[model samples]
Target: MKQPLLDMRGIVKSFSGVRALNGVSIQLEKGEVLSVCGENGSGKSTLMKVLSGVWPFASYEGEIFFEGSQVKASSIRDTEVLGIVIIHQELALVKELSVLENIFLGNELGSFARLDDEAMYRRTSELLARVKLDVLPDTLVRDLGVGQQQLVEIAKALNKNVKLLILDEPTSSLTSTEIEILLNIVSELKAQGIACIYISHKLDEVLSLSDWVAVIRDGEHIATKAAADLTQNDIIGMMVGRQLDELFPREVHDIGEVILRVSHATAMQAGASRPQVDDVSFKLHQGEILGIAGLIGSGRTELMQCLYGCYDGQYSVNIELEGKEKAIRSQRTALQAGIAMVPEDRKRHGIVPIMSVGRNITLSVLDNYKALFGAIDEDKESQDIDDYIARLKVKTASADLAIKNLSGGNQQKAIIAKCLLTHPKILILDEPTRGIDVGAKYEIYKLMFALVKEGVSIIMVSSELPEVIGISDRVLVMHEGKLKGDFGYRGLTQEIIMNCAIKEGA
Candidate 1:
């Protein structure tokens, strides 16, 4: 019986007519790591936002007790002053700024009218060392990869003298080594009596690190139990309110003839230390879901980019479609060849945030929805948009709503629907379910099964082992810009795949 460090009672949050969190309650003890589990739109992030003052005092109805005192935070500054900090899924670092500058961007070292660069840099270097990123303090954020950028975000949080840290999908983009370092840091923090609220879809890490677990379903608190008392299946059951029959609905299909093939693919970028893709060669056949598994910056993205012709270079990658060679030098060519790519960052590259759902859904197939002599057919577009919205089960009032109005999971479904309209033969999905919730992940997996049944080939790159193992018919492990091993569904296990990902002798 240690006294609870923080207690949230009767939390109720709403948006318009929809309830995001309804009378949910939970508690955190000093030095305790409590994991909040829920699918997308389940109110986990919303709860964290409330705690971190992203929602502020008057925005929601709740009583938050911190250190035996009722606290009302007016803003993020107030929350930080109470020693509570949050690292969001979409990092807050400025790419153009150096590591030290980004870390101390708002919190400068000197008194009100002066700047102290030396003190800031020295403190930043110490923080970086604590996180075990020995890179130079002057290195710009854009110069670092996604994994390193994640560490920078954590370091930024540590700089705030955080006592209660809320991390939303902190390891989504980290490498195996980086993940271990972060886990170690959490252990150290706990020893010093710092509490943590880790929100992640990565169940293995959740079970390993969390002392207690709380599950939320559809904005309702389901249960809170000790880590040892609950299993992964129990967490899933609590989150979705039902037992999931299978994690991945993988089906066996006859392998068809080679539909897409890449040979000797190479990309050269300035000052990258190594080629982004080094003579990568692989063949993708019809009715196949080829999964490319790797850590961040291991060249999976670059390989796909090269195949889609997004890089600038004298690359010599031979492509064979229907047993004949074809030149693909641009994105237009890739799309014309019936290849559709669902990029990694949906907000940045996948969709137009401000546009209507109808417009976003019909953007890819607009050519087909046009009348004679370049006239756009509004009726046809509306009908097709309606069909996709229903098909994807997008939770929206109507197709006329702004794309930004939907939740992250629904936004992802909209992007997938947009790609489906292209009716491509080969589909490339990069971290398709990165920030989405469990129910949304199930929907995406079902969609994939339906697509594969229709003879479309899929190339998925994911950091989640369950996703890679569950959905892929075959897994290709990439390490240090090269394919290290390949495993079929029948022969693959998480342990073996991880071993392949980090082979002997580096």
Candidate 2:
């Protein structure tokens, strides 16, 4: 038999005393694409970490073979030297650095004694062109949008002479158009004989890109089959160990009188020509799921930030809570006034990754757990934390485990739990299920219904149009920071929403 380009055997990784990967094994050939799919916390990313040296050799029991030779890599650099590269789910680019600087941050060109700026600039330009990213090499990463930043990361990867590549949820923060560009880039790379292990919750992309699909459940390899023979339902069934009939489980809930009204909200950045949020006005009712839909940069997030009192720029808003005009100047004020928000970038703004899961959940409501002379009431706090953890069905080894160790879906649930502890009358969810699996997204959708059934109004800002149409009682479309169309969800479709969002006067 011909030797495969890469082979991993008997990969077993444990955290503390619990096994995350149970003797998982797989093989990949050159010029082939293998997509790994699973539910959240199903050990998909863990398996990739083992192969990419993120978990390092000797830390786990596994045999890795590259080009028919056994390999033991101690660090990511070691794997990179052997033509293996990985782009993590969470971005690793330094915000302070420019695109050219980030692409060649450590891997510079020229002699040992001196660096080559001209050579580096030329190579960066070539990489940027290869990735179809129309951006200046000297452009700062901080100034770019999330999708642009994602492309920049891809550009960085293409700069390396890689034989095997790994992408973990690369399209999680991208727009649909940008997603297509990325998919095309991946196809181009496959044509160049680069083997790729694609890990994502998006099964459609998996089917479209992969020559084979590998499904894992609870850290165990389930099955590997030709992508041409497998359907999305087949993959989902393998990942979750059951058939999920409905991806979007929307329930009927009563939408009552307007509990909150936001009028003429406008947010302006320091150097921008126009406001981020332009004269946005809307009303959210009791027990209502009001979804805000737009392209990523259409100011949906900015409007929500303005309402939550977290917008970085100058903004003015007139809010009426329960028929009384109110002022929300900060997050504390928003929370105190019966409003809570689960921000867009969960890793950056929602959770403190270093903190324990239990602690992170109760962070916003710490004052509620205070006892005696400025010390936390451990007993009461743990009880509340446990309750929320159970309520949200967050899968973790222990509440005391660092939240960073949990899956992306679980981390999002913890952030939602933190917001819920505020007991807010209205909840703001921005990109609530950005990188979550289909199963987890269903759970969150069900939870949204449950919350609204309990009289908690919700305003969901999402880039996904199907989600906006499915779970929303009403939909508000935004374009260029302005409200373009507000409609009942009864007859709403993605086309109608997109038309309104893209065509200014539609």
Candidate 3:
């Protein structure tokens, strides 16, 4: 048999005495693509870290072999010398730097005495062309969209002459078209004899891009099989240890009378020719899961921000609650008016990472726990925090652990818990499940159902059509800051939503 291009045997990794990877192993041939699928904390990222030398050689018990030779990588740089590269989920580009500058930031060409700008530019152009990104070499990274930046990351990897590229949740934030472009780029890379270890929660993308699929559950490698032989159901079963019979657990409930209405909501930024949200007016009823569906730049998030009193630019709106006109000018005012929002970018806007999970959950209601002389009622606060953590099923080693220590899905649930603590009549979830795994997504969907059944209105802005259609009672489609269509869930379809989003409602 031909020797495999890469082999990993008996990989065992632990974190703080807890095993995160237990004797997991995988093998790949030249020009092949392997996808690792698992839940958020199922050791997928841990294993990848070990392979890329982020955990270093002595940190884990593993034997790695590449090109029929034993490998020992003490650092990421050591592995990079042998053509191993990893692109993390959170992009590592300097926003202020130009494309060419970022690509050669650490690994500049030419002699140590001086840099070679001309050579770097030419190489950057070639790398950009290879990745199919149509941008000038001098364009600033900040001006590029998320999709463009992702392509730039790949170009950086190519510049390293990467033989085995490991992508961790690469398409988690990309639009459908962007995702298609990236998948095509991966196909091209494979044709050039570059092997890849792709990790993501998106099962369809895995099945389409990979030759083999590896499933891990709670730090244990379950199985590996040819992608052609495994369906999405099979992968989900292995990842979660059971068949997730329904991807979306839709619930039936009655939508009450309109509790809130907005008229002529418009938000505009400085020097921008157009409003981000242009005269979009809508009504949200009690116990209703009103979904806002649109493409990435369709102003779904902007509209929600307007309602939540957090839009950064100038805004004008007429909001009514229970037939009474109200003014909501800030997040504090919005919360006081019985409206709460869980933002799109959670790491930046939702939680204080250094704060404990219990404290983060109680952040919105800190005043509610105030005692005499402005002292915090620690006993009451602790009880309430415990209750919310249990109620939300936020899996944490302990409530005292920093919120950053939890996985993306658990952090999201904690954010939701914080919102629920406000006892808001309306809740806004902007891309709440953006990078979360399937198991967590299902749990969040179930929680949404439970919330709506209790008369807490919800406005969910999502880029995913299936999620919007499956969990929403009513769908509102937006396009270019305009409300294009409104349809009842009884007969809603993704095709109808997209048609309205691309043009006008038909």
Runs with alpha carbons beyond 4 Å of true place in candidate 3: 504-506
The per-model lDDT (C-alpha) reads 0.86, 0.91, 0.90
Cα-based TM-score, every candidate: 0.92, 0.98, 0.96
Residue-wise C-alpha lDDT for candidate 1, range 183-226, written one tens digit per residue: 89998999999999998887888999999999998789998999
Where's the lowest-lDDT run of ten residues in candidate 2? Answer: 497-506
**Better candidate by lDDT, 1 or 3:** 3
For candidate 1, report its TM-score.
0.92
The residue pairs in collision within model 1 are: 40-437
TM-score (C-alpha) between model 3 and the true structure: 0.96
Note each model's CA RMSD in angstroms.
Answer: 2.6, 1.2, 1.8
Clashing residue pairs in candidate 3 are none
| Best-to-worst ranking by lDDT | 2, 3, 1
User: Which number leads on lDDT?
Assistant: 2
Among these predicted structures, which one has the highest TM-score? 2
Better of 1 and 2 by TM-score: 2
lDDT of model 3 at position 424 = 88
